[model samples]
Target: MYEDHARIPPPPDGGYNLNALKPGNIRHYDYWPEPPGPQTFGNTQVIFSDHEKHMVARIRQADAVFGCMAWLTNYAILDALAGLEAVQIVVQKEDFLRPDGPGWRKTKLLRAYKALDKNLMRFNIPWDVGSCDQCGDPSIEGVRCMGVHNSGRKSASPRMHHKFLVFCHLADGYPEPYAVWTGSFNATWNGTRCRENSMYIESEPIASAYAQEYGTVAALSEPLDWQYAWVAPEWRIGS
Candidate 1:
């Protein structure tokens, strides 16, 4: 897909027409490692000038704003949509799951979920859940969350692999927001100490495609033969 674009016609001047030599395949250009130059560094700086402000103002006033991979800063995006009349939220199950078992962390998550639900309901917004095939145990459908291995082997791993999903949302006419992150970052205070980067963009096509893929995975989740680690049933509730 990295071919060059079609060449332009030669100019009337006798001088060699460089435009005529333009590569026909626009995709052929090498784009690895974005061209380097002086970099800007600081916090709370006015990066946008009057022209930029005017342009963005028009854009924001028009219809929608799309964003992606916002990670830890996702809460800010949610706050932006909170006042809207209605919004649709698509989120990965792991985003709400507690990594340290069912303790204070899990309780906090449940409470947060309840709060979010209440807030969204007030605005007539709805939140949807999405899961990956890797979640739960494979031996029995929906049995994986119970923390049991499908295999009879007594030495099976104890922890179940939970699928992480990106959250997306749409408010007003704007497209849904999406965020993704990697590494050791979890939904915990300690995880926030690690280095991380996230981006936000506005694009309907991208959001739609992601939402569709998430829907497909949510549908395909089923029972399998994968082994799962088991934890005490008592730990499944509040700490």
Candidate 2:
């Protein structure tokens, strides 16, 4: 991890919006207080805190969820995923990216990983971790990378940098591909601070394609090691 990086970086511009990609009622997460109005990037609508809310709301409605996230440390989104009842879910994430640090502490990332494991265990859900070849962290084992095969090779691209979520059913009980959420947004605090855009596609074909892709990636990935003997519990959520 880049231990010298700023904890809260300056916000960037020109990102995607969820509403602009598909036509549907605007989704919002009520758990957190409402944020400011929508932001726009040229002709496209841009959502910041609202985008996070939209994602939480979508996760609330899903009967099953499958996704790939390049980074994850957002508590609200994690809670939403953990709270799902009777829903089958599998999320693939990159553990070696953007880890929190104050000179090699990495306390935030360790806590996030532990929280995710706790949540998954509570609900009996499944999850996977990507290869560490890109990170070159000898401590972590690279079972199988998601996007690229044989990522262990020095010439190969080692990161599975995809950010997407697919919901198979809504509250109305659709069979599958109820919607697909994809964007540049990461589920970390820093990700929200930056200018980002996301789109929700409600097409069966498109969602189906993503769902299939998720399956293939998941097949190549490895589940979290519950023992986690190599990692220490750094901190607790909301600490």
User: Which candidate has the highest TM-score of all?
Assistant: 2
- Per-residue alpha-carbon lDDT of candidate 1 for residues 1-239, written as tens digits (9 for 90 to 100): 63545344444863433312434544555433322322234311121212222222323332222211112123333343333332223222232243444577556544443332222221111111222232333111111122343345556444333222233444562235343211222222322333322222234454455545433432322122222233223111111
* Model 2 lDDT per residue over 61-124, tens place: 8766666776666878867766553233233333443243254435654554444332112112
Error of 2 at 113 (Å): 5.9
Alpha-carbon runs more than 4 Å astray in model 1: 1-102, 118-187, 220-239
In candidate 1, residue 4 scores what lDDT? 40
- In candidate 2, list every pair of residues with a backbone clash: 15-197, 16-197, 16-198
Top candidate when judged by lDDT against the true structure: 2
TM-score per prediction, in order, is: 0.32, 0.51
Ten-residue stretch with the least lDDT total in model 2: 119-128
**Residue 186: error of model 1 in Å?**
4.4
- lDDT by candidate, in order shown: 0.30, 0.51
